[model samples]
Target: MWQNEPPVAGDLPAEQGIPTLITWNHGGNVVAVEGSWDSWTSRKMLQRSGKDHSILLVLPSGIYHYKFIVDGVQRYIPSRSSFCS
Candidate 1:
């Protein structure tokens, strides 16, 4: 799990065995997650994306089309300009 001990590296799951989000946004006193998974995401994260905002749904699955999400939103490519750049 951990390379050493004490404080963990960031908020990311060391194992990543259980799909989840590692980061969140702090706005208006609410801790908003960056990504959403499952059906609960609409009730949490997506609603905050702003009506003027449009998310690019990229499901680059290899086969069977199985993609994991956070809160309920699809996982994004951090290297892509549409996401982070």
Candidate 2:
């Protein structure tokens, strides 16, 4: 599950942020996530979970944009009217 919202009754204090589970279901030899959290600088690695790849991120409450790097290819979920970059 790719959750963009901050969890309620979080594991950590509100100031410290909460652990959010991010999962990538697309198949790839390598999978990672980059987002506004680090201005896309840090490519956090995701471990394989059955057929999906996932990672736990501790993020503060806010809106964030993210993309997946699958086997070195940057991918985004396209909207119905837009094409994938």
Candidate 3:
């Protein structure tokens, strides 16, 4: 949820999956290597939390990707030009 924040406590259900789940970072900032973040506290907590349940806050590598067409040719334009001003 946040980079420099503590776990949020609430009455959430761990049913089907981890009690409390957090998707990508608040701003989709990939923090670490592939599975390298596996050692982080969030992963650890997911491990210790219980069985049939898990939690992980992975830091994915940053990337700028998008599908577009340029010069009459199809292209995978990852740049911000697609959303230009």
Candidate 2 collision pairs? none
**Candidate 3 C-alpha lDDT tens digits along 1-85:** 6587655655454434223232222121122112222332221222222222234432343331222222233333233322211
On a 0 to 1 TM-score scale, where does candidate 3 land against the true structure? 0.18
Best by TM-score: 2
Estimate, for each residue in 18-44, the C-alpha lDDT of model 1 and write its tens digit: 322223222222222333233334423
Predicted model with the maximum lDDT: 2
- Please write out the lDDT profile of model 2 over residues 1-85, one tens digit for every residue: 8889776775656577667777778688789888887687899999997899899888877767788889989887664212122
The list of candidate 2 runs beyond 4 A from truth reads 1-14, 79-85
Model 1 pairs in collision: 35-70, 36-70, 36-71, 36-72, 36-73, 37-70, 37-71, 37-72
Question: Candidate 1 overall Cα lDDT vs. reference?
Answer: 0.32
Q: In the order shown, what is each candidate's alpha-carbon RMSD?
A: 12.4, 11.0, 17.7
* After superposition, candidate 1 runs with Cα above 4 Å error: 1-21, 25-28, 34-36, 39-85
Error of 3 at 65 (Å): 24
Q: Which stretches of candidate 3 lie over 4 Å from their true place?
A: 1-35, 38-43, 47-50, 62-85
Report residue 13 deviation for candidate 2 (angstroms).
6.3
